[model samples]
Structures are given as C-alpha cells and as structure tokens.
Target: MTSSLPLLLLALCSLSAAEAQLTVFNLRASDLPSGIVVTTDGYVKVFCGSASLGETSVRNNDPNPWWEEKFTYFQGQENDVLRLEVHDSDIFFNDLLGVCQRQINFMREHDCFLESGGLLHYSYTLNGNNQ
Candidate 1:
C-alpha cells in the first residue's frame, strides 16, 4: 500500500506538470482580412496586399502614410511553429481601443484593477518570462 501511494503521488504530480505546461493562444480582432496566413511561431508575414506598403495605410492623403500596428502571438514546438496575426483594419485604432476597454472592465469586475495599481499596466509574457 505504501509503494502504491508513492506511485499515485508521482502520477498526480506528472499530470499537474502537464496541465501547467499547456499554453493557449488567443487572438481577438474585430475583423480578419483575407489572404493572411498565420504561422505557428507568431511571425506575421504579409504575403500579398493591394498596396505593398507593409501595412494598411491610415491616411490616404499623405504620400507616405504610416503603417498600422500589427499584433501577433506565436508558440514554437521543436521545429514546428504556431502563429496568429491580428491585422490592422480600416478602423484598427477604434477596435484596439474597444479591446482595451473590455479588458479594463474585465479586470475591474475581477477586482484585479486596483486603484493603487495606477493606470493598468500591460506587458507581454514570452517563454515564462515577462517582456
């Protein structure tokens, strides 16, 4: 019985470790444009577009318009890579703002957004380390 207990504990520990290592990739965007391919490693490469400016142009009046901020998330598994891209849409700024608002509301509802926290901080966490 004592030996069986040790084995059971070991099994439980292994199970917990597996669960802890299971990571999920989530991409929330208001719109996903066509002809966009997402890789496993999170590198967003634009294959084709109407204009070759690297990103969507916000101001058509300007000859040299600025590119919209492109957001992506990726995970690697040995030689395999998984990536997701949230391309900037025509109304990207507004969409991003809406996402931020929703996040703030969620944090507030969970009591995680404390007054002392001072203007909700957001940073990326990659490979078990905060970036």
Candidate 2:
C-alpha cells in the first residue's frame, strides 16, 4: 500500500485542481408588491450545494430594481443544482420573496428568471475549465 501512496496523493491533488467558473449577470426585477408603504430592500442569495457564493447589495425602495452585479464561483458538478433565493431585508427579520433552482449544466448562456410572486431576470454562463 505504501508503494502506491504517492501516486494516489498526486491523483487526488489534480482532481481538486480541476475547476470551472460560473458567472451570474443582469439581475433585475419589476412589478413587485409595495408592502405597507415601506421601502423594500431586495437582495439575492446564491448557492451551489452548501457553498454560498455571496449576494448582491440591497436596492432600497426600488420595486423595479436592476442589479447588474456579476459573481464568479468555483463550479460544482455539471448535474448539481444552483439555487437562488430572493428576500426583502428588514430590521428584525427578512421576508422571502421567491426561490429558484436550475441545473449547472443548463445555466450556461441561458436566461434564468424566477417569477412567481414577483419578476426577476438574470443569466448564467460558464467559462472553460480552470486548472
């Protein structure tokens, strides 16, 4: 077992180095419900598996908000699902606006919008393998 230990270690290291890139762009929403005449701070949380790639800044008081924020993350497996959750930020607790999910393989160069209670438009694209 010891004789093959070095080769096994090398293979594992190379596997970890194999990576892909995920880009999220042009997130905007309109026709949102104005609640109680209060400012709605809308933001998004993006996740691939358990790893969070962070979120966009809150757009205060704008029901029709455009967040052209771009984010990059270490891509998961091709079949893994990417989850996006939109929320309204509040002082005490935040309200969930919507939830969306898409497979990583289908995200590339495709428009992914989640509109149930509100309107949201965004796109995801994948870059070549990064090693």
Candidate 3:
C-alpha cells in the first residue's frame, strides 16, 4: 500500500536512532540575591563532547542545593549536545554559575530537559534512544 509507505518510513527512522539514559534530577537553587561570596561549595558539571561525564557533590552553605546526577551514553548522536556547568567550589578560583545546553535530538523528542541557571534548576532525563 503506497510502496509500503517507503519501507515504513525507513523503519521508523531506524528506531529513532537508539541510545539514551541521561538523568540529572532535583538539582535545585531557589531564592537568590547574594553575590560576592565566592567559595561556598557547589558543583555540577556534565559535558558530552570531549568526554567529562561526571560531577556533583559539593554542597556546603547550600542555596537550595540538591544534586541527583546520573549519566550514560553509548554512541549518542543527533548532534549530541548536553553540556551543563555550574560551579562554585573553589579553593583558589572556581566560580562559574551559569551554562546550559540541550540537543540530543531535543532530549529525545522532549523526553526530558529543564535547564536553568542563576537560581539553578537543571533536570534532564532521556532514557532510551539511539542514532
């Protein structure tokens, strides 16, 4: 029927190009307006290019901090872009509290992605995809 619908839409675009499972949950930061206090234990750094898939565990003097991070990737494509950086845990200098990105096919077609900086709120979860 209609040439088998172009081979079933190329087998559903090759099963939506598989490989996924990116969970970073409950990472919070609320009610802010206190600047110029650099060095108060804070962490969150996840990148998916040049490989540095790890971070989070430095929450002292927390400003609504709660990092439940998890990451896994296996040949992730669709212009992979999941880079988040929010740091304040400094011994000499490490204060960068802003940065967000999302483009693993738009987090696997809106499976998950809620990124924010400055009063942080970054929760991205896309479990199951491959491309």
Candidate 4:
C-alpha cells in the first residue's frame, strides 16, 4: 500500500474543482395569507444547504406578490438542492408562509408549487459547471 502512495498523490493533485454560478430570477406568488396583519407582506429567503444566496424585497399588502428581483450565488454545485422559503414579514418575527425544494438543474424555468397551498413562479440558471 505504501508503494502506491506517490501515484495516489499525483492523481489527486491533478483533479480540478468545478465552480459554478447560480442565478435566481424574479418570483411571483399567489394566495399568500396575511400573518397577523392587515395584508400579507411577502418576501423570499433563499438557501442552498446552509449557505444563504440572497433574498427579494418585501412586497406589502398583497395576496399576490410579484417581485422582479434577482439574486446570484457563485459557489453552486449541480447536485446541490435549494430551499426557497416564502415568509410574511412583520415587526417582531417573520412568519413562514410556504417552502419548496429542488435539485439543481439546467432547465430554463422552475414552476414550483409550495407545500402550503400557493403558486410560485420563478426560474434559475446554472452556468460554468458544464451544464
């Protein structure tokens, strides 16, 4: 086993790590409930595993919120899964409205349906990781 140690080191050193970027496009939602408020102040908190990509701005007083905001993360893997959480913003604490998750893909759009009865219209692009 000791004789092959040098060869193993050479092989390991030759491997190149892949780097990619993930871009989350605009998001739109419908039927979001008001959480202890007169209207629903909705926003999105994005995550890939423990890393937070970014979030959109809060859209106030609307059951249907359309945020034409985009967020980007530079260290995305093709096998990585994303957690898209919809929340109702408030003064003290933010209320979770819905959640949906999906594996990274090379598709053009992702029409996600939140588990708590709503529609999420968003898309993403993964670039520079060989698709």
lDDT top scorer: 4
Query: By descending TM-score, how would the candidates be arranged?
Result: 4, 2, 3, 1
Question: What stretches of model 4 exceed 4 Å from their correct place?
Answer: 1-16, 35-37
- TM per candidate: 0.22, 0.75, 0.33, 0.79
* Alpha-carbon lDDT, every model: 0.24, 0.74, 0.62, 0.80
**Candidate 1 TM-score, true structure as reference:** 0.22
Candidate 3 lDDT, 51-127, residue by residue in tens: 77888887877656677766665555556777767777766887776666667554432222223334666655555
| Model 1: per-residue Cα lDDT at residue 2 | 50
Between prediction 2 and prediction 3, the one with superior lDDT is 2
Q: Model 4 Cα displacement at 131 (Å)?
A: 0.6
* Model 1 misplaced regions, further than 4 Å: 20-84, 88-131
Tens digits of per-residue lDDT for model 4 on 52-122? 97788999898899998887888887878887899888889988888878888766576677665577778
| Candidate 3 local lDDT, residue 75 | 51
Shift of residue 12 alpha carbon in model 1, Å: 1.4
Candidate 1 local Cα displacement, residue 111, angstroms: 19
lDDT of 2: 0.74
Answer with 2 or 4, whichever has the higher TM-score.
4
RMSD to native, candidate 1: 15.2
